[model samples]
Structures are given as structure tokens and as C-alpha cells.
Target: MHLLRIALASLANRRFTALLTVFAIALSVCLLLAVERVRHEARASFASTISGTDLIVGARAGSLNLLLYSVFRIGNATNNIRWTSYEQLAAHRQVKWAIPISLGDSHRGYRVLGTSQGYFEHYRYARSQPLRLREGRPFAADPFEVVLGAEVAEALHYRLGDDLVLAHGVASISLLKHDDKPFRVVGVLARTGTPVDRTLHISLAGMQALHVDWQGGMPARGAARVSAEQARAMDLQPEQITAVLLGLHSKIATFSLQREINEYRGEPLLAILPGVALQELWSLMGTAEQALFVVSLFVVLTGLIGMLTAILTSLNERRREMAILRSVGARPWHIAGLLVLEALALALAGALLGLALLYLGIAAAQGPVQAHYGLYLALTVPTLYEWTLLGAILAAALLMGGVPAWRAYRQSLADGLSIRL
Candidate 1:
């Protein structure tokens, strides 16, 4: 306890340098923990993006590609499956429920998804949590009515009953607009921390009505144009769709059904187990995640090195102090132990300050991060892994402290009662 007091007093004497060192380490520690937290949350969010659905079926394409477009709303489909194909598969003996997905439309920057009411009844995420509306009910009966995702409504400041026009293509700044067939927002889905939060939902009939008058990728001019009322009066059943999500009556029949779908005589289709595809997708991204973690580790090492440099640089100025201790019958080991204590003090203080900073940052940025990125950064206690990382950091600091501790030990012994010039 006496040696600890002396070490702390010594640090207090050089409080400015000590504080700077502590702050540097704190920033590095905060960065490392922040990166780790985001990586963890993102992985959880990615895995929970879609659940309850057993298989994702799309026109024959790479499994990763199909998963990306179908579930993630990323990338365009290579080919669309015939509506008849979706109906046939949806009616299979083992199939419990199916949700057909129709893509290729957008409102502002958000992608528009045309799906059936079964989507609301059957789709789930984050441990089988059902989709709940924040304000109104899901679109029913009227084909021109739409449902907005939480992020879409919040970012665009849209409210229930607001009319919005969807663009003809998926581009953020699409030139072709479906202005003649404007849709009213009937509902806003609660945030799911998934890609669903960034999408706009509409009925398949609404999607077909938007492009009904278009011929050869161009909207009909003058005499051939179909008005919104005309579209409502005509048949609007979708001819083709982008993909389908299926739930099975029994998990045992999944493989058999997948094989059957892949070898269908009508069209080339690819059916992938959602869990398997998600794992495969994550494997492709693991390299980048590891690289990011390594970069943060190097940053932490740099901070520790700075602490060592500060302490070693101060050792020269404190040589007289060490000599005085030696003259007062202090052992060389005592001097070494004091230096180690100081290093440990700096590291512990930095780690605590970094933890406080991490929580503060999460509290402040939680809303914006969720709204913009659809990533919910829960402000929770650090996990065992995080504690382990901190323990490793402190251990590394103790090892680094040994270098200066040994140097001080040798100097104290050699200098004895004489002050070095």
C-alpha cells in the first residue's frame, strides 16, 4: 500500500503526461470495443433477417445471388419465375405457406416489394417475431393501397393515408414514374432491424397495374394509355414474379422438396434452405470482418506502445528519484514493482474510461443508426468475449510494463546513492 501511494503520487506529479497517455489508450480501447460491438450486432441482424421460412426459391441462379435478391433486396434477379410456377409450388403437399415476391420498383431510394397478404401472416424475423404495424392495418382489398416500412416512413416523413408514386425501375433516381397510378400508404410496419425495414410493400396486383400500359419497356403514349381506373377494371394478375419464400409442413420433407423444385420440368428453379444460404453468405464476408478486427487490434497495440514510450521517456528524469529510494534502503525490486503498478494503473483507468465512452456513444447514436442503417445497437452489458478482450489488453500492458520495469530495476541498482548526470 505504501509503494502504491508513492507510485500514484509520482503519477500525480506528472499528471499532464499521465492524463494524455490515459486518454490515448481510452480512445483506442473505445474504438476496438465499438468495432467488436458493431460486428456482433451486424452478424445477429444478418442472421435474423428472415426466419420461419424454410426455403427461398428463385429463377435458377447462384444460391448467394438468389438469397441476396430475394431476402436482402440487393441486386436484381437474373430471371423471374413464372407466376404459374410459384402457384404450382405453393400448392405442393408438403408446403404450408408461400409468399411471392415481385421486385423492380422504387419510391425515392427505397425498393418496392409486391407481395401477397400471406407475407404479413407468415413472414417472420428475429426468432419468429411476427410483423406488427406501428400505425394502421395492412393493405386489404384495394390494389392501390400500400404498406410502408418503418424506416421508409420515418426517413421520408410519410404518414398513413399519404399518397406516393412508385418509379418504374429500382434505381434511386428513376426517370420513369408511375404517377398515373399513385398508391396510398395504408400501414407502416414496425422496425425489424432487417432489410424489410428499408422496403416499401404493395400488393402484386398494384405492381401489375403500374406496368400494364407499358409496351416493350416503354409506357404507352396518348391513345393506348391505361388510366388507374381502367387498370382497376381489368385483370391485374401478375404474369411472373421475382422469387418465393416457402414454409414446410415438416422439416423432414425439406430436402425432397428442394430436389423436386430444382428438377422441375416447367422452369429452371433454385431452392435453397434459408439457414444454409445465410451461413454460406456469411462465410464469404468473414474475411473482411476478420481484416477489420485485425486493424482495430493494431490500433490498440499502437496505443499501448505510446504508453510505453511515455513511461520510458520519463524514466531518465526520474533517475534521481530512483537513486534517492535506493539510498533510503529501498530494494531494486521495489522500484521495478512501482513502475509496473503505474503501467497497470494507466491501463485500468483507460479501460474504464473507454467503457463509459462506449455506452455514452451508443445511447446518443442509437436512434439515428437504427433509422438510417436498420441496425439496432442495443445498449447492454459487455459480453464474456468483451471482458476477455479487455483482460487480454491488460495482460499485454503488464508484459509491456516489464520492459521499463527491468530497466528501472537495473538503473536503481547501478546508481545506488549517486545521481546520474
Candidate 2:
């Protein structure tokens, strides 16, 4: 305890340098921890993007491709499943519910999804949490009514009763605009921190009506053009859809259903367990995640090196102090112990300050991050892994301090009672 007091007093005498060292370490520590937290949260968010659905069925394609287009709204599907097949599968006894997904439309830059009221009823994310509306109700009988996702509504500044036109294609800058089939926003879903938030939802009938008058991928001219009312009056049953999300009646039936769907003779189809596909997707990204973590580790090492440099540089100026202590009967090990204590003190202070900064940053950026990126950075206590990382940092600091401690020990023994420069 006496040695700790002396070491702290000595650091107080050089408060400016010590503070700078601590601040440097604090910034590095904060950065490392922040990256780790984001990585963990991103993985969790990615895995929870679509949950409670036992299987995702799509027209024959790679599992990753199907997962991307179906859940992520990424690339276009190679082929669309026939609506007849969807009806047959949905009516299967093993299937509890099925939500069909129709893509290839966009509102501004956001993807427009054509689904039934079943999507709003059964689609879930983040631990089976059901979709909730922030305002208004889900689209009812009106084929022209639409429901806006949280991000779509917030980013485009749309509200209930607002009318918007969707383009025929999924391009960000689409040439073929479905101007005649204007849809009214009847509902806005709450922010879900998933791809769902970045999508615009509409009924399957609405999707068919948009392109009902278009032939050969081009809109009809003059009398051939169908107005919204005319299209609504006609049958709007969808012929094909991009994918289907299925919930099984029992968890044990997931594999059986998947096998059956894969072997279906009605049409070529692929069914993948959502959990398996998610794990596969995450593994593909593991390399980049590890690379990021390694980079942050090097940053932390750089900060520790800076601390080592500061301590070693101060050694010459403090030689006289060490000699005085030796003259006053201080043992060489005592001097070494003091230097180690100083390093530990700096590390502890830095770790604490870094934790404080992390929480403050999370609190400040939580809203904007979620608003723009759909990544909710929860302000919660550090997990066990984080605590372990901090502990490792302290241990590394202690190990690094040994270098200066050994130098101080040798110098104090040799320069006993003598002032060196």
C-alpha cells in the first residue's frame, strides 16, 4: 500500500504525461471494444433478421442466393415459384402458415415487397417477436393500399394516407414507373432493425395490378393502358412469386418438410432451414470480422507501446529520484515494483475511462445508427467477453511494464547514492 501511494504520487508529479498516456490507451481500448460490440450485435441482428420461420423455400438456386433475395432483398431471384405450387404447399398439413414474397418492384430506392396479410400476421424477427404497426392498420381489402416499413416511411417522410407510385423494376433509378397505379400508405410498421424496416409492403394483388397492363415488360399505350380502377376490377391473382417463408406445425417436422419441398415434382424448388442458412452466411463473413478484430488489436498494442515509450523516456529524468530512494534504504525490487504499479495504474484508469466513453458514444449514436443503418446499438452492461478483453489488456500492460521495471531495478542498484545526469 505504501509503495502504491509513492507510485501514484510520482505519477501525480508528472500528471500531464501520465494523463496523455492514459488518454491514448483509453481511445484505443474504446475503439477495440466498440468494434467487438458492433460485431456481436451485427451477428445477432443478422441471425434475427427472420425468425420463427422453419424453412425458406424458393425457386431452385443456391441457399445463399435464395436467402439473400428472400430475406435481405438483395439480388434478384433467378426464377420465381409458381403461385399454384405456393397454394399447394401452404395447404399442406405439416405447414402451419406460409408467407409468399413477391419482389422486382421499388419505391424510390427501397424494395417493394408484395405479400399477403399473412405476412403481417405471421412474419417475425428477433426471437419470434411479431411485427407491430407504428401507425394505421395493415392493408385490408383494397388492392391499391400499401404498408410502409419504418425506414421507408422515416427516410421518405411518408405518412398514413400518403400516395406513392412504385416502379416496375427493383433498380434504384428505374425507367418504368407505374404512375397509373398509385398506392395509398395505410400502415407504417415499427422499426425492427432488420431488412424489413427498409422495405415497402403491399398486397399480392397490388403487385399484379401494377404490371397488369404491361405486356412484354413494356407498358401498353392508349386504349390498352389499364387504369388503377380497371385493374382492380379485373382478377389480380399473382401467377408467380419470388419465395415463401414457412412455419411448420412442429419443430421436428422442419427437415421432413424441407426434404419434401426439395423433392417436389410439381416444379424445381429448394427449401433451407433459416438457422442453417444464417449460420452459413455468417461463416462467409467470419474472415472479414476476424480481420477487423485483428486490426483493432494492433491499435491497442500501439497504444501500449506508446505507454512503454513514455515510461522508458522518463527513466533518465527520474534516475536521480531512484538514486535518492536507494540512499534512503529502498531495495531494488521495491523500485521495480513501483514502476509496475505505475503501469498497472495507468492501464486501470484507461480501461475505466474507455468503458465510460463507449457508453457515452452508444447513448449518443443509438438513434441515428438505427435510423440510418437499422442497427440498434443497445446500451447495456459489458458482456463477459468484454470483461475478459479488459482483463487481458491489463495483463498485457503488466507484462509490458516488466521491461521498464527491470531497467529501473538495475539502475537503482548501480547508481546508489549517485545522481546520473
lDDT of 2: 0.92
lDDT of each: 0.91, 0.92
- Candidate 2 per-residue C-alpha lDDT over 182-204 given as tens digits, one digit per residue, 9 for 90 to 100: 99999999888888989999999
- Top model number, TM-score: 2
How far out, in Å, is residue 2 in model 2? 2.8
Assess the local accuracy of residue 161 in candidate 2 as a C-alpha lDDT between 0 and 100: 94
Clashing pairs in 2: none
- Report lDDT (Cα) of residue 347, candidate 2: 93
RMSD of each: 2.5, 2.0
- Poorest stretch of ten by lDDT in candidate 1: 412-421
Looking at model 2, report the run of 10 residues with the lowest lDDT sum. Answer: 412-421
Off by over 4 Å in 2: 363-381, 412-421
